[model samples]
Target: MRKVMFAMNISIDGCHEHTHFNPGEDLMDYFTGLMQDTGVIVYGRKTYELMVPFWPEVAKNRTGRPCDVAFADAMTRIEKIVLSRTLENADETTRIVRGDPEGLIRELKQQPGEKIAFSSTSLLPRLLEAGLIDELYLIVHPVLVGENKRLFDNFLVPEKLNYRLEYTRLFKSGAMALHYQKSE
Candidate 1:
């Protein structure tokens, strides 16, 4: 079975607003590496809309820094699954899935593939509650955005979910990449 990995960038204060922090070259490279290793990426409607046109355009035009371009290229190569009830269509590489995201992910895990990555903050709570995430990568940035949606804003698990830290890397930008595996 493929491992389900949940990755996101968060502020020291737990804010998950993407625009709040600018990822440096090292951080961008880190993300690129993650994308390279992932076979499939799952996003919510909001994240898919924010990423698709922008990343695909970047990949096509080869704009921005080298790291950015590489990250965009990697993003464009991966298969994407968007879980949204209202989204009617997506690009060729993406599939718009409606209803029962948990079930869909569960089914995906049973199939042979590389790691499945989750990139949507809105769906994090649901995924955690369902105990579907096998690994987690939290890129904790140094700065704090005082007022933004937090990483666990709506997470209300009945019991604690445990994870063991498997790896940690600190970038020059002061952001730290923390990799954790779900504890047995």
Candidate 2:
């Protein structure tokens, strides 16, 4: 069976609340590695917009230090499907798909290839409610905020995860990489 990896950058208190996209280098390297292994990448609408513009152009003419270069490079080849009601078009490599979101995911799980889903907090909750996720890779960050998106806040159902500690790493910037496998 293919694994659906829910990799994200969250707070130290298990809160994914963030003001803006500031995923660190360690986290980027880690996910980029996983994304390299994955043949397909599924992302939420917000995530798509945040990530799409920086790709394949080496941070889109931004001077100085490169941000997520591996991620930009890897994203060019990996097939991406962005789930959005508002997004009308995608670039040459990607396809903008509109439909009942979960219904589409349910169908993808039955097909072939190693698939991975990025920070679709909205969709992840639904998948958990449906008991469909096979694996999850979450990266815990250091900061916390007053108003931002929390991964499980909008989740409708409670899930008891039988997970295994796959890997753990501490970054110099006071971040932690917490990898969990849904054992059940």
Candidate 3:
């Protein structure tokens, strides 16, 4: 079965606002590498809006640093699945999927794919609670956002979920990328 990986960047204090953290070239490069193994990326409407036009535009314009441009290119090329009932349309590389997001994800996992990646904070709790995520990647940045949406504020699992640390990578910007797999 393909792995369902939930990856996100969070602040030291558990804030999940992407803009709160400053990811350097190394971090961007690392994410770009992660994209290489991902066949489909899943996002909630909010994240989709934040990532779409911006990254695709960046890829087309070849803007930002070399690493950023490369990451943008990779992001634009990869297939994206957005789970939103209200979203009406998306770009060519993106598919807007509605009705039972969890069921759709389970079906996607059974299909042939490299990895099903998830990057939406709004959907994290639901995925975790449903035990749909096979792996988790948390890039902890070395900063604190006093007030914002927290990482696990709404996380409520029926039973305690256990995860085994698979690996970790420390970036030059003092950010740490932690990879964890669900303990079988």
Overlapping backbone residue pairs in candidate 2 total: 0
lDDT of each: 0.92, 0.72, 0.91
TM-score of each: 0.97, 0.84, 0.97
lDDT of 1 by residue, 54-109 (tens): 99999999999999999999999999999999998899999988989899899999
Instruction: Report the number of backbone clashes for model 1.
Output: 0
**How well is each residue in 50-158 modelled by candidate 3, as lDDT tens digits?**
9999999999998899998999988888899999999999998898989788898899899997999987787888988888999999999998888998989988889
- Name the best candidate (by lDDT): 1
| Clash totals for all candidate models | 0, 0, 0
C-alpha positional error of residue 130 in candidate 1 after TM-score superposition, expressed in Å: 1.0
User: Model 3 segments beyond 4 Å from truth?
Assistant: none
- lDDT-wise, the better of 1 and 2 is 1
- Clashing residue pairs, candidate 3? none
Mind giving the per-residue lDDT tens digits that candidate 2 earns over 66-130? 43666777666788889888887776777777877777677777788876664577788887777
Ranking by lDDT: 1, 3, 2
